[model samples]
Target: MNHPPLAGHPADTGLELCEGSALQERGLAVSFDIQLWDHPARAFALRFDGRPVAYVNRCAHVPAEMDWQPDHFLDDSGEWIMCAIHGAIYDPRDGRCAGGPCPGGKLIEVKVDERDGKVYWYPSADVQPAFPD
Candidate 1:
């Protein structure tokens, strides 16, 4: 599983995730691998309300992957992020729990920025790019 480094994107601009056009409003997400707390993990980015958002794919309630289908995180209505397993819903804007088993819980968000027709995710202390910089 070798992933080529994102070409042309400097570290200061963050790691490129996908093309901005790849994410449609409430459409399929663009999934990516990450290193969460030094462990391999999955994350995804999608568009909602005309903006891009991302999160570590783990559910707030059970720490399980939440997409109902691969790259599908939004509920049927395309309004909220629904956990595939336990029905936990989260606001796409800020990853805050909107309803379900995990009251007051929130998704672990991956900071993202969209510019120059591309989407980029920023790594934090707990989250890092899966590939070496």
Candidate 2:
């Protein structure tokens, strides 16, 4: 299904991310990309309470990717998102920093929608689709 542009911004993602098989367990993660601050930036989506939540991959602590490995953002307990660099823990549901160096900080959320068995991401003023380099 095609979605019309929003605020002159086209749909940033397609249905490829709708494959929810990998999200059966909480904390499972998937990675995607978007344009942030006019630069290519990595973002990730994770399963939490059977729902998909996404955020810019940057850690609130020091502006670094949080995953220890590609698409690996969850800790062993599968309860929270973990930053490999500074050990920052973020609430997967809302991206709020729950503990560690990041206090009163939160991950940048990327708007996503799941409908008719498809998943799509929407771009906002601050975050847009990343062009191929």
All models, RMSD in angstroms = 4.4, 4.5
By summed lDDT, which 10 consecutive residues of candidate 2 come out lowest? 1-10
Compared with the true structure, model 2 gives a TM-score of 0.84
Candidate 2 on 55-117: residue-level lDDT in tens? 998999999888888888888988889999989999988999999999999999987766665
The residue pairs that clash in candidate 2, if any, are none
Q: Each candidate: what lDDT? A: 0.89, 0.77
Off by over 4 Å in 1: 1-11
| Candidate 2 C-alpha RMSD relative to the actual structure | 4.5
Taking the tens digit of each residue's C-alpha lDDT, what string does model 1 give over 31-127? 9999887788999999999888999999989989999999999998988999989899999999999999989899999999899999999877667
- The alpha-carbon lDDT assigned to residue 105 of candidate 1 equals 95
Model 2 segments beyond 4 Å from truth? 1-16
List TM-score per model, in order. Answer: 0.89, 0.84
